[model samples]
Target: MELSLDAKDTAFRDEVREFFSTGVPDSWRDRVRAGLRLSPDELTGYQQRLAARGWGAPTWPVEYGGTGWTPTQLCVFWSEAARADAPHQFHQGLELIGPIIFSYGSPEQKDYYLPRIIQAQDWWCQGYSEPGAGSDLASLRARADRDGDDYVLNGQKTWTSYAHVASQVFLLARTSHEARRQQGISLILAPMDTPGFRINPIATMDEKYHTNELFMDNARVPVANRVGDEGRGWEYGKVLLDRERMVAAANVIFLGQIVRGITDAARRRKIRGRALADDPGFAAKLAQFTVELTTLQAMVLRLLDDMTRGADSGPRGSMVKLRWSQLYQAGTALWVEALGPEAAQFAALDGATLPADMPAALQGALYARVTSIYGGSSEIQHNIIARRALGL
Candidate 1:
C-alpha cells in the first residue's frame, strides 16, 4: 500500500500539527516527549482541549462530536500526535466505551454518556478480566442478578486498569446460569463510587499503580445500565474486544518509542569506545527492527482499509495484535541488548522527571513484556487466528 500523504491529506496534516502545537500545553508536550506519565488532570485537560475542537472522538459519527475523518486521516492524526509526543487521549473514552455505547446503547444512554465522554467529564475503565479469567473471558464468574429494577453485582475484577481514577466501568457479568458460558453474560455499567465496591491497587513491574483489583459485593446498578440485550454479553463483548485489539495494535506511540530507542542505542557504545550502531551485528538488529515496524504498519493500514470497506477483520485483528506484540517485544529486547547493563539501572521515569537523553527506555522495555500478556495474550490471539481465520 502506498503510504504517502496526498495534497488534501497534507493540508489536513498541517492543520492538525498546528492545532496540536498551539492548542496542547507546552508542559504536557514536554513531559510526553521526555517519557513521563501524565497526571489524570493533565490527561483530562488535553482531552478537553481536543473535545473543544471537535476532535475528541476521531472515529465516531459527526453527530457525536467526532471528526468523521477517513481512515487515512485518522492514521495521520495518530502518527503526527506520536511524532509530537502528545499524550494519548483517545483510548478509554473515545476508542473503547464511546463506540460500545453508541453502537449498543439506547438514545437516553447515548444522551447521558456521550456528552460526558466527549467533554472528558467521566473517566472510564474496563471491568472485563478477573483473576481466573484473563484470556479465558468466557469463563468469567462475576455474577449480576436482577432484583426488581436493579442488578445486584457480586464478583471480583482483576487487572482493571485505571479503576481507582475512573468514574465509571463497563463490565461483563454473568446474568444466567442455565445458558452456556458465553450465552449467560450481560454488559453492565458500574459506577466506581457505588457502595460495596472496592478498588485495591496492584503494584506493577514498572512501579506504577495504574492497574487494580476491583471487588463488588451486592453492588446495585439500574437495569437501564445494561448495554444491550440480556444473555448477549459475549456477542457484544466480541465487538468491543475486536475493536480494542485493533486500536491497541495501532498504537503508533510504541513504534515511535522503538525508533527513539534504536537512535539512542546507535549513539551509545558497548565495549572499549565502539558505537553500538557501528557494530555490524547491532546494525543488522536495527535493520530487522525497521523491517518489522514497516510490516506492522502495512498490516495496520490494510486492516484500516478493510474497516473502511465495512469488512470485518474478525480474527485478523488478532493477527495484527500478535505481529505488533512480537515486533514490539523484539525491538525492546534489541534495545536492552544495546544498552547492556544500563537497561537494569534505568528506572521507569514519569513524564515529569524524564531526562533529555533516553530516559526510561529500559523501563519501557520491561513494560512491553506485559504487552503480549494483556489484551488477550499472544497465545490466545494465535488461537483465535487459527480457529476463526484458518479454519483450524
Candidate 2:
C-alpha cells in the first residue's frame, strides 16, 4: 500500500504535531525521554491532561469519549506523541480492560468505570500472570470461591505491573475445576484496597520498581465485580490479548527514540580521529537496522489498515509482534555495543546517567530483553503462527 499524507492528512498531522509540542508538559516529556517511570501522582496529572484534550481513549467508541479518528489520524497522533516523548494514556485502563469493559461490561459497569477511567480517577493494572502463569496464562491458579454475594479470592500474582499503586487490578481467577483448565475462569475487577489483597515490590536491574508480586488471602470481591459471565474469562482474555497484538507495533515509538539517541551519540564520538558515525562498518549496521525498522513499520501500517477494513489481523499480528520485539532487542543491543567503554561506566552504577546517552542505551538494552516476553513471548507467538497461521 502506498502510504503518503495528502492535503487533508497533512493538515491533520500538523494539528496533531502542534498539539503534542505545546500540550504536553516539559517535565513530563523530559521524564519519558530519560526512561524514568512517572510517580502515581505525576501519572494521574498527565493522564487527566490528556483526557481533557479528548485524546484519552482515541480508539474507543465515540460514545465512550473516543476521538473517532481515522486509522491514519491515529497513526499521526501516536507518531507525534512519540516524537515529542510525551506520556501516553495508561494502556491498562485505556487500551486493555477499557475495551473489554465497554464490549462486555454491564451497562452499570460502563456508566461507572468508563468515566472514572477517562477522568484518571481509577488506575488499572493487569493481573493475568500468576506465580506460574506468565506465558501460559491459562494455567493461573488464583481462585475465587463463590460465597453468596461475594467470592473469596486466594492466590498470588507475580509480575503485575503497577499493582502497588494502581487503584484496581483486573485478574483472571478459577471458579471451578471440573471442566477444562481454561474453562471455569472468571475476570474480576479487584480494588487495590480490598481486604486481604497485598503487594510486594519487585525491583529490577533498571533501578526501577517496575513490577510487583500480589497476594490475595480470602479477599471478598462482589459477584458484580465479575466481568461478563463466569467460566468465560479465557474468551475475554483473548480479546484483550488480540488488542495487545495490535498495539505491539507500538514498540516502534520507543525504537525510534533509541535509534535517534544512538545516532546522536555516534555523531559526537570519534573513532580513530573520525566521528563514530563516519565508520563504514558502523554505518552499514545502522543501515541494516533502518531497513528492518522500516519494514516493521510498514507491517504496522498494514495491520492498522486491516483493522480499519474489518479484517482479522490475527496470526499476522503474531508475526508482527514477534518481529517488533526481536528487532527492538537487536537495536538496543547494538546501541549498547556501540557505546563500548561508555557502557562500562553504567555497568557499575546500576545504569549510568552521565553522558546521557549511555544510560539511555544501557537501560534500553536491559529493558529490551523483556520485550520478547511480555504481551506474549516470542515462543508463544511462534506457536500461534505455526498452529493457526500455517496449520502445522
Q: Which candidate has the highest lDDT of all?
A: 2
lDDT of 1 by residue, 1-392 (tens): 23588899999989888886765555554335334357788888888888888888877788877788888888878777776667667477777788888888899989999999989999999999999998788899999999999999999999998998999999999999855688889989978999989999999886656889999999999999999899887787555765764485447433654666566666765566788888888788788888777877877887778877878777767777777677767776676687676555554456444233333555556566787898778898888788887889
RMSD of each: 3.1, 2.5
- Give the lowest summed-lDDT range of ten residues in model 2: 27-36
Give one digit per residue, the lDDT tens place, for model 2 in 204-305.
Answer: 877667899999999999999999998898888677655764476555544555566667677878888998888999999988988888888888888788
TM, every model:
0.90, 0.93
Q: CA lDDT of each candidate?
A: 0.77, 0.79
At residue 171, give the lDDT of candidate 2.
91
- Kindly give the number of clashing pairs for every candidate: 3, 0
Residue pairs of candidate 2 with colliding backbone atoms: none
How well does candidate 2 score on lDDT at residue 252?
Answer: 56
